[model samples]
Target chain A: MNKIILLNNRPTGKPQASDFKFTDENKPEIAKGEILLKTKFVSVDPYLRGRMSNAESYVEPFKLNKPISSGCIAEVVESKNESFKKGDFVSGSLDWKEYQVSNGKGLLTIDASIAPLSTYLGILGMTGLTAYLGLTEIGVPKKGETIVVSGAAGAVGSVVGQIGKILGCHVVGIAGTDEKVAMLKSKFGFDDAINYNTTKDIKKAIATACPNGIDVYFDNVGGDISDNVHANINRFGRIIVCGAISAYNETSVPTGPRVEHFLIRKSVLMQGFIIGNYVEKFPEGIKQLSKWLQEGKLTYTETIVEGFDTIPQAFMDLFEGKNTGKMIVKI
Target chain B: MNKIILLNNRPTGKPQASDFKFTDENKPEIAKGEILLKTKFVSVDPYLRGRMSNAESYVEPFKLNKPISSGCIAEVVESKNESFKKGDFVSGSLDWKEYQVSNGKGLLTIDASIAPLSTYLGILGMTGLTAYLGLTEIGVPKKGETIVVSGAAGAVGSVVGQIGKILGCHVVGIAGTDEKVAMLKSKFGFDDAINYNTTKDIKKAIATACPNGIDVYFDNVGGDISDNVHANINRFGRIIVCGAISAYNETSVPTGPRVEHFLIRKSVLMQGFIIGNYVEKFPEGIKQLSKWLQEGKLTYTETIVEGFDTIPQAFMDLFEGKNTGKMIVKI
Candidate 1:
């Protein structure tokens, strides 16, 4: 018997605890080219909110009475294919349950001795890749340039700021709280950090932090913060849109910044990027990221909640800006 | 004596005739390093409206009681510098004036025999450079791909659409009137043309015209039309923001479709471009544009408004989308 959390109904706004129901299910089947995996950590990202509501999106919405799926780090218990065997750790699209099956695709094998299993769910997995590709490919940072990041304490933003620092650019991070701001400077080595909740004039705050104006902006929380950054972007600046956590939960359309003139005057390049879209380039990216980790040039932190029953709370916490780093639920 | 229009006051909204006053003044003397020239053609563009307002922009706003300046083609009558002589055709940053004396630093000598003097104000000049840079550098069109251009019958937009067709891409043009739409297909050689004013559902109209969705969008009129194009932008689409004639006269923020989400889903690249900033590479751009014209790969049209006294109305007419191609005032 395996414990699984199944979607009861499509959520309208903020998902309630009743929206997901925890139940026991029989799971022991391994068909041809399939492997049975035990969940070590179930990742909860803000994008899951989009999946909770049935809307036109990049991926299909989760159906009712089915377990929610995400990038989970799991241990291969049994295998029917040559790719994996018993005791091999893998990470890919998996269910929020004790064990599930994957048919060799979208699954990644990880070495347990190299890093902790939960690290794969946060740093070495999708979250880190989101930051890596977004910064290097989309952000296209230059040496000595300033890169501003919103939602700086979150998984992707934190990694982005750290990577910006590693790439020799001045990194300014904007978060919701004082603690997150402190974490950005102290833990991530960002040049400057701003608590947006405390700042009255965000544009002034960004200008004060970045005297020369922003060169690259990795937008994770796009609302007024994006507008503030848009106002101060330098000529030929690059803006990378990774996510918009601020607007994802809204039941209605939020008033965003009127930015057309700013784009024209500055000739800024604003590009959006998703990590999954770069699957073919994953091996090269992962190899470089692994080397950066081994060289101590890169570091990551994950906030873990124990038990599968805490998945709903873990996901809910993402919207409230509760977690400091990548929010992961250890099963 | 020379006739010139001086900026009497800053415009509150769409500029009227009262905002400028025509006056006769003594012809400016040629200084030690200056040249005296007679204005031949003056460019009346949408960007001039932005220059009239006292706002912080990429270019310095026009001062009150000063004649508004724009790109103009002139004939040199007197020269104190050795580089220029009488009867030489020159293009430079002059004002809405009949005759002016200027330093030779910013002026470029031109051969009117190669192309018409008005062509220097339109296809062979700033409008051409704007379209070239906006499409090649910003839009980055791929061969066999589809490109959609807004304000398609206007100066920059028409050239951009024609360049798209020349690049072997199917070009869809969106203009204001049915006549303009017909002209876009017939004169500009566009694959399809849409009169956005007549189209009930712009998204559906664009979808019907471009079954593959717009891969490269050269946006000139930025409002609901831009929003409609953005909603249907293909994955990895590039949008080049050359001008926003629709929003130039707007006193308050324009209300339309929200775009922060589009940045996330499509990984779209929206950039603004100005020709002056690319001065370092302008010669190269001009050479290519000139070669295209000489080879008959490029065709150009001009909406010539005769008389120096008609400059104010020529400029005002741009706000109403009155011009078919490049709006030039023949002095």
Candidate 2:
């Protein structure tokens, strides 16, 4: 029997395991213009939390009692479509199911020889593209400039810090744990890393870490941490608002110091970046990210859990700061 | 003897008369390569409030016991410099003095034949440039889109609303009083106006006014009013951080709802604008403004207080929303 996960309820604040429902299903059959795909890897992310809520967001919310979908790599088990063949691997937005039927519409035939199939859901996929495009397009980091990344140990943040380092920037990472902080500096090659959870005064810690002042801020975690980063921001700074994972769990509206004074006083620019909007420039982003990965200039880490049943728990673990890098579910 | 207004003390909160000292000095004679200037119109602005404090800003803070300077119109009383002759009017960042000597550095020779002398310090000058540049460059309002201007009765806001109309946008203005609100619709050609001071709920009022949602916001007043604007902001919105008159006088830091969720959800862009940064684009900005003014598409209002003695009072009144448009003191 095939298994599938569905949104049992629209998550209120912090998502719980009960919010999702998993059930057994018959393997979906392939039609004349379709292909039957066996799910290989599923990408679970903090941004997925936004889609779990019934609010207007960058992406549409997942419907109740329907299959929850995200970026997934699948193998063509049975093909009736001319565009895809049996045993071929493709990656695209696919549903959470052991077996599903697709018309081969948005799927990209990714090569397994170049990298691991699971890496297609991470460093070489949307994760890398988000980091590369968001940092270069929005952050616009200059050589010798200080670049700070919040949620620094996560999928996008880890990649962003690596890219910043490659660009010859004074890259700094802010994460929750000392272990993640150590990984950011030792593994990701960030100049420094601040454990925000341990730091009594995040603003002061940022000030010390970025003595020259933060010129570009890659914000994945927003709220008071972002507010503290603003305090240490430099004149003519650029803030790339990627994700507000920090505020995603809050039932009440998050309040903090007004930004107009910082913006006006410093002549700063803050832009919200959604990677889907930069599809036309994906080739450029992918090419650069690929080159860096090949040259060993860029490195990535992932927390993979085996089995289809671990998907919801893996997603929920994201908010608890459980995952250090890309959180992936391999079935 | 020459008359001058000097900053007596760095204001702690709202500026008082005691914060300024009117002093007398001997009028300076013009030397070779220098011109004697007689102050004609003194431009008093809310932004001057920022300069009065020792805080670092886009512009330098006013030094204690030193004559405060702003965009002023002056007549050439005597000329030893080739650039200027007797009776020629020039505008520049001039000192707050009845008579002063200049070497014609950084001064723009104004044509009284084109507009009034005081108009050089206003619509034809920095105020016009700020509105035009901040709105077009940052706000980037597209035709049929909704544009909202806060502090819509003031100098920059008034011009911003007019320009929004010219750009074929649905222009909405937010001001403090019923009179200013009426003027915004009647005189400034704003499609809708909201009296924020009297409005029970600013966010609801904004939502009602902008049914299509706010595509662009020209923010002159920050704090709660700006927070309300963000609530009504649409996806891919643009906010121009021109000024924050609302927070200028606050003794403590002004706090509000955090902007990350709003920005990230919408893919919005928020940029702070200072007119000085766009000096290279001044010619382009001036040409557009000049054409609009000449064609009668753009009209301006001024609250002119008589004499240099009223300069400090006129500036202080800006915080009270006393000025309909540009606040000037005719010396």
Candidate 3:
């Protein structure tokens, strides 16, 4: 028997566990040129929350009563494909189930000796590529310039701040908790970190952190936090709009301060892009990220929730900012 | 004797005639390597409003009780420099006075036979350079793309729309009056024109006009009109923030719909710039503009207010959308 989870309901605000349903189904059969994979780990990212709603987005919305899916690390138990073989570890988009059938089309074989299998879904995977591409391509941080990152404790933002430091920039991060702030400074080497949740005036806090003003802004949390950051941006600044996790779960369209005057006055540039836009440069990005990791210039952390039943809870935790880094469900 | 206009008081909202005071002063004398210039035509632009305030901006604010200065076309009455001779027509920044003393360093001799002297204050000058640089650099319009321009009847916006047409793009113009809208379509060769003043729903109007969606936006009006234009932008849209005439007179900071999520979802790029930033590329811009003028591909209009006393009134008319194109004060 194969157990899978389906999206049962659309969430209005914060998602509830009841929005997902767990059920059992017959194991899928792998035909010729196909591989049968046993699930090892499932990635629960903030972007998944956007798929839960029936709204037009970069990706299609998740259909009701359909198996919810995301990035997953799996082991091939059986393979009819010459590209993959039994006992080989692979990574691909897969449903939240114990077993799945794949044609090995989008699946990539993973080398366990490079790093842990779960990290392939995180630091060495889409998360790392997102941070590297968005920061370098859009933000374009220069040496001695101040780089500010919002949602600093999250998977992508943590890497962005670390890369900013590596490029000889003064990095400042805004996270939700004091613990996350401490992690950003102590572990990630962020020059300064502010706990946005406890700060009375975010604008003042940002001003204090960035004495010379923000030259590059890697925005993961949009809303008031972004407004504050925009207010403190330097002349010829760059703002890379990565994600707006703060407004993702809102029932209505979110609104905040307009930035036209700010941008015009400062001669700033604000660009919004997804990692997929840089697909042609992924090999370059992965090569650099891997090199940095090997040289011990980069580090990452993960919050692993064991058991297939914890997938929904782990995903919902993203909206609550409960995970310090990449959130994963280990089966 | 030299008659000049000085700033009587800083304006809180919309400026008034009383904000300027006319005074008489002794004629300035030209020293060695300098020229004594008799003012001919003064350029009254919307950007001047930003300099009237005590706020920090790209250019320093005008000092209290000092003569207001702007781009002016003048005749060299006496020359002490080898580069300039008496009776030569030149353009440069000059105080709002009948006569000015210049070091001939920043002055550029203009050939009146090439274009009208007043046009040197408009089409062949800063206004034309603004349109060329902002459109080509930031807007980056492609052939077959749809370009929407706000304040389309104004100096910079008019040129931007015409350039879009020359680039084989579908051009749409948004103006404040029906007459201006008609001029944009009939005279300026814009493919479509909308009267934003009479439109009930700007968003729906933009959607109707730009059926294919806006690929590039040359924004001069930055309030609800811009918010509507931003909503109708296509994927990978580009917004060139040139000016914010709509908010220039607002007593408090203006607020409108936020665009971070919109930019993120569509992978849009928004950039703000002043023409001065492209000083190094002026020769390139002027060559293109001069070629278009000579080829009869570009035409410009100006509303000339005779007499030096009318300078303040002409400037105030910009905020009211009373000028069709460049507003000039002939002194």
Candidate 4:
């Protein structure tokens, strides 16, 4: 029997584990030109929260009563496809099920020896590519310039700050807790990290942290935090709008101080992009990320929950600021 | 005697003529390498309002009890400089007075035969260059794409829409009156025009006009109108923030709907810039603007208020949307 999680209902303000229902069914079978995959590691991302709503977005909404899907690291249990042999590790967009059958079209056979299989679901995968492209293409961080990133303890923001440091920038991070702030400074080598939850005046805290003013801002959490960052951007600054995890669960569109005046005064540039736009550059991104990993210049951390039943809870924990870094479920 | 306008007091909300005081002083003498200029036309621009406030900005504030300065087209009455001659027409930053002295360091000699002297204050001078660079470098309007210009009947915006038409784009203009709206479509050749003052729902009107969505937004008026445009921007859209006339007079920063979420979902690029940023490219801008003028592809209009004493009133009229195009003072 196979266990799967289904989106039973849409979320209101904050998502709950009860929103998803677990059910058991027969394991999917493999046919000609297909391979049967046993789930190994499943990624729980902030962007998935956007898919739970019916609003128009970069990706389609997850339908009710349908199996929820995300990036999954799986092992081939049986194979009829010549390309994917049994016992091989691969990654692809797969269902939250114990077993899945794929035609091997979108699957990429990953080498676990190069790095852990879970790393392919994170630092060497979509999150890493998002950081690389957003920072280089949009943020365009220069040496000696200051780069500030919000949600600094999360999966994408952690990678973004590391890349900023690698590019010779003064990196400042904003996270929710002192523990996360300490990890950012000690583990990630961020020049300074602010605890947004403890700080009363975010604007003043950011001003103190970034004395030279911000040149590039990687925004993962948007709201008053972004408003404060905008107030201090230098001339010709670049803002990379990666996500708005702060407002993703709101039933209505969120409102904050308008940014046009600030943007015009400083002659700044702000851009928003999704990782799918750089699909053609994935191989290059993977190569560079892997090289950095091998050089010991980049390190990653993950919070793993040890069962498929915890998938819903792990995803909800992202909003609660309960996870230190990338949150994944080991099935 | 030299007559000049002085800023008596800062405005609280909307500027009135009482904020300025007309005074007379001794006539200045020209020194070596200097030329005595007889002011012919003085420009009253929306950006001048920003200079009236004692705030950090691209340009310095107008000091109280001192003569305000603006772009002036003048005739050289006496030339002690080798670069300028008697009776030569020139344009440069000068005090708001009938007679003034210059060193000719930042002055550009103009030929009135090529274009009117006041055209140097409008279409062939800083205003023209502003429209050109903001549209091309930032807006980046592509053929068949829809380009929307707010404050569409004003000096900078009129030129922006006309340039959009020349670039083979479906140009849409947003103005405050029906007459300006008609002028935009008939005289400026905009494909469509919206009267933001009369429209009940600007977002719906823009949606109906631009079924394909806005590809480029040339913003001059920033407030509620900009909020509506942001809601309808297409994927990969470019928003050029040239001026924020709507908020220049407010005592405090204005609030509106947040754009970070909208920007992130569509992968849009929004940038703010001053014309001074493109100073190195002025020669290119002038050459292109001149070519367009000679080709009869671009035309300009001005509301020339007679007498220098009306300069204060002319500047105030901008906020009230009293002038259709460039507002200037004929001295």
All-Cα superposition RMSD per candidate: 2.1, 1.2, 1.3, 1.3
- Can you tell me the CAPRI class of model 1? medium
Q: Candidate 3: misplaced stretches above 4 Å? A: none
**Per-residue accuracy of model 3 over B1-331 as CA lDDT, tens digit each:** 7898999988989998888999998988878988899999999998888889998788989998999999999999999999999999999888999998888878899999998999888888999999989999998889999999999999888998899999999999999888999999989999999998899998999999999999999999888899899889998999999998888888777877678788888899999978989999888988899999999999998988899878999998888888888899898
Candidate with top lDDT is 2
Best model per DockQ: 2
Native contacts retained, all candidates in order: 0.64, 0.88, 0.82, 0.81
TM per model? 0.95, 0.98, 0.98, 0.98
Better of 1 and 3 by DockQ: 3
Global Cα lDDT for candidate 2: 0.92
Output the lDDT of residue B202, model 2. Answer: 85
DockQ values per model: 0.62, 0.87, 0.78, 0.80
Q: Write the per-residue lDDT of candidate 4 for residues B257-286, one digit (tens) a residue.
A: 778788888888989879989999899999
Give residue B119's lDDT in candidate 3 (0 to 100).
86
- Which lDDT tens digits does candidate 3 get at residues A1-331? 8999999998889899999999999998989999999999999988888888987777789999999999999999999999999999998888888999998888889999999998898889999999999999998888999999999999999999999999999999999899999999999999999998899999999999999999999999899899999989999999999999988888876777668888888999999979878889988998899999999999999999999989999999888788988999999
**Candidate 4 chain B, which ten residues in sequence have the lowest lDDT sum?**
B255-264
Docking class for candidate 2 = high
lDDT of 1 by residue, A191-304 (tens): 999998999998999999999899999999888888888878898898888888888878866665456787887878888787878888777777877888889988887888
For candidate 1, write residues B112-185 as lDDT tens digits: 88888888888888899899987998788999899999999988888898899888998999998999998888
- Ranking of models by DockQ: 2, 4, 3, 1
Q: Candidate 1 chain B — worst ten consecutive residues by lDDT sum? A: B252-261
- A215 Cα displacement, candidate 3 (Å): 0.6
